[model samples]
Target chain A: MTRLVVLSAGLGVPSSTTLLADRLAAAVVRRLGGEAEGRVEVERVELRRLAHPLADRLTTGFAGEELAAALEAVHGADALVAVTPVYAASYSGLFKTFVDVLDRDALEGTPVVVAATGGTPRHSMVLDHALRPLFAHLRAVVAPTGVFAATDDFGDAGLDDRVERAAGELVALLSGTATTRTRPTEDERLADPTPFEELLRRAGAGPTG
Target chain B: MQLGIFSVGDVTTDPTTGRTPTEHERIRAQVAIALKAEEIGLDVVALGQHHNPPFVASAPTTTLAWIGAQTRRILLSTATTLITTTDPVRIAEDYATLQHLTGGRVDLMMGRGNTGPVYPWFGKDIREGINLAVENYALLHRLWREDVVDWQGRFRTPLQGFTATPRPLDGVAPFVWHGSIRSPEIAEQAAYYGDGFFHNHIFWPPEHAAQMVRLYRERFEHYGHGRADQAYVGLGGQFFMRKDSQAAVREFRPYFDNAPVYGHGPSLEDFTSQTPLTVGSPQQVLERTLGFREHVGDYQRQLFLVDHAGLPLKTVLEQLDLLGEILPDLRAGFAEGRPAHVPDAPTHAALVAARADQEVPA
Candidate 1:
């Protein structure tokens, strides 16, 4: 089954960032589920509820129960929808902090749909300059059509088409139309680890004892 | 089971009194604490090693030796001895000297020290922590067992025709435990050598501890040392107990809130739930500690961090007294329904006998 996770870094109770994320997630689900070969599950991670825990993790050097599960879900998903409000021409600190706390290899080669909400369209470059580069560093495959919804664009009719385009790109990737695949996940590596002898050899410390 | 206390040896101001112990006082307090452990019949006394300030465990062997000279039966160990930055030759020589001075009551845990600048300060890099641990420990393992050593490795200068002085006591090295917060490589290293695996159970969630221990045990069995259940495992914990659970909470809350590494992050309530920071009556502490075996299975060595975050030395003494009170029952609980085949933690005598057993005239 394909798992799609949505991380909405909107601080408000009814923030436009979350609205854009929900629209994109729904669009991907609709297209992926329509296929006979596809069975998809969706999980939404609201970053607001996890704000304190994220800060706590920064200080504590470990994730709490709720934050850990959220991280696990995001890492496990076949596709991800990450939306954040643009702040000072960048993704919100809350969004960036969440990404920073995730394991470096957490999103490797996972198809990600990047979205943003800002007060004006000028801040929309956050998708290219901030979000895409961030996920790129994580080795994730950012969907080509990024959906950016400014406050005015959310009121306009053009937002829906961008969401649809972005979702279609994500669905295509999830359908394996794109060859950007993943290395073994952390769980896979842990469950079937390299033999200690091999690791010792790599470290140049053989079993001389 | 070997019940003990492993102190990080941090110097923090007591929030209630707003007074911090001087390094001299803290040092003396730790020595006194270890002596008390021997007096009260606790099995082990371990200290952490840190190169940075606010932590006085930078020279564990010095402190442990001082304590060892005054005590007889109590085992001396480290919460961790930094295997990465410290030269293997030094670890071999120093710990071997300690083994002699302590009269065979010495063991140590290998750890990759965490503080970022500490690596570069020691002419090493943090990125090479796992490598340094593996390579250095390999050299240390050989140095302890072999009469002469010739070695070359990535992180250190090569050694040739060198012998570690004062070879291990009775030709038996102190037992080693590898400690890691979450690194699987360290766990695998521990398994590769059939060493004890120690998980610091107070910082992260219990599930994380269980996962690390599970990997170590499975790899231990894979390495053909013994059954998975028979592998040596040590866990670290924290507690603040009083006769009344509420009083325990009341007394420990300030220290918990401002403690380093995790302070000012999660509330005490949430932190207690996430990690093994049990602050309650002695009964609750015992039950919660005993509950650890449910997940990690029967294991050897249970160490508690009792003297950090500026809890006064007096309170720490009281905590040890309480720990001593429950240790017999805790030992019984750990020993209950135990398989006869599982081995207790190896002591010097046991290692000597095992060594003698391996040598037959055939």
Candidate 2:
């Protein structure tokens, strides 16, 4: 079974970003099957709830219980659906702060579906221009099709088509059938007990008179 | 177990009084705190090294050497000597001189300074912090153990046929403790050299300290040092005490609310419950400190952060008196039912005597 985690960086109770996240999560479940009978298990984390704790973590350099639980959910998920509200032509500050708190190598090879909600269609390119590159920097395998929901797109059939396509891509990735090639697992990529002899050799080959 | 105090030597304004000590006053207060530790029968006094504003303990060896001249029994150690930027040869020479002057009352804790600007100021790149720690300490280790050393390593000029004067006190290097907050590589390094591991047990929860100590102990045994239980471990704690717990809280709350490092974050109650900071009576401090062995197992040293967060020198000295009141109970409680195979914290005289034993016949 695949565990899917949805991270919504929406600041309000009924935020459009969170609405998009719920739709994406439901689409993932529907692609698997019905809700109770689906092979995909879903968990949702609202970064809005973690704003104060994230700020505290920034100051103290350690996570509180709530932030730690959110981080654990992200780290342990088989695939992640991240939805954020667009602000200043980029992801919201809260979304970026949450991402900043994660371990550098935490998302090394995980599959991710990036989505965003904005007031205008002009900000639609944020999915590729900002969110895609951010996840790419983290080494996450972002889906080729990113979903952007404008104020009017929420009730339109085109939004449904985009969600379905992105969710299908995610399911394919989870089932090991996606065209998106997988990166090496962390254990396979990292050299355990990093060869000390190589380190010594590097030390010996230093600048000298 | 060795019990004492460690100071970061921060020069913050006392929130209760809105007054900050002059740098000279703060430095002299640290010396007075060390002297009071000895007078109160504490075992060790460690000072931290910081090279920035709001902190004054940039020269720990010089401060410790001055304290050594005034005191007789208290162990003078650094909360951490920066191993990443400081030249290893200077470390070898200066610490040997300190060991000789103190008659072996000196041991050092090595740590990578966290301040980024300090790294470049000392001609080091913070990116190579772990590599610098690994290579610098490797050379520092050889300099003390071998008199005529031929060494070459990254991060420093090569040395050939050079001796780090003084040759250590009685041909025995000062005991070393590797201090770390989160780095597993440091734990491995400490274990590989059979040195002590110290967790700055103040800012974080017990589970974090337990996890780090467990890794160190497991690796210590894996490196053929000894059984996991025999690995030397030290922990740092912070406390505020009065005759009454309520008075203690009322007196320390202002400092807790406005002090640096942890203030303005978790509430005082929440922070105390989560970390090792105990602000209460002598009995309460003793109970919480004794509970440490429950998570990390039997350990050798316990150091407290008694003189930080802008508490006045008189208030800190009073806190030391409270510690002296409970010192006997703490030692006895920690000693109760401790396994016989576990080793005590290494001391100058004890280490020298152990070396002497190794050289003599059965």
Interface RMSD to the true structure, each candidate: 3.6, 4.1
DockQ category of candidate 2: acceptable
Candidate 2, residues A1-209: lDDT per residue as tens digits? Answer: 67789999988788999999999999988888755875767889999889988887876778889898898778777889999999999999999999999878777778899999999999999999999999999998899989999999977999999999999998887776442334433322321333434444444555322
The digit string of per-residue lDDT tens for model 1 on B54-133 reads: 98888999999899889989999987899999998999999999999978999999999888999999999887787788
Clashes in model 2: which pairs? none
- Deviating ranges (above 4 Å) for candidate 1: A33-38, A176-183, A205-209
Per-residue accuracy of model 2 over B1-362 as CA lDDT, tens digit each: 89989998899999998999999999999999999999999999999988899899988889999999999899989988999988999999999999989998999999999989999999998877877888888899999999899977768888889999989998889899999988777877888889999999799988888888888888888888899999999999999999999999999999998879988887889788878999999999999999999889999999999888899999999999999999999989988999999999889788888888888988
State the DockQ of every prediction. Answer: 0.47, 0.33
Candidate-wise lDDT, in order: 0.88, 0.88
Candidate 2 residue runs with Cα over 4 Å from true position = A177-209
Chain B TM-scores across candidates: 0.98, 0.98
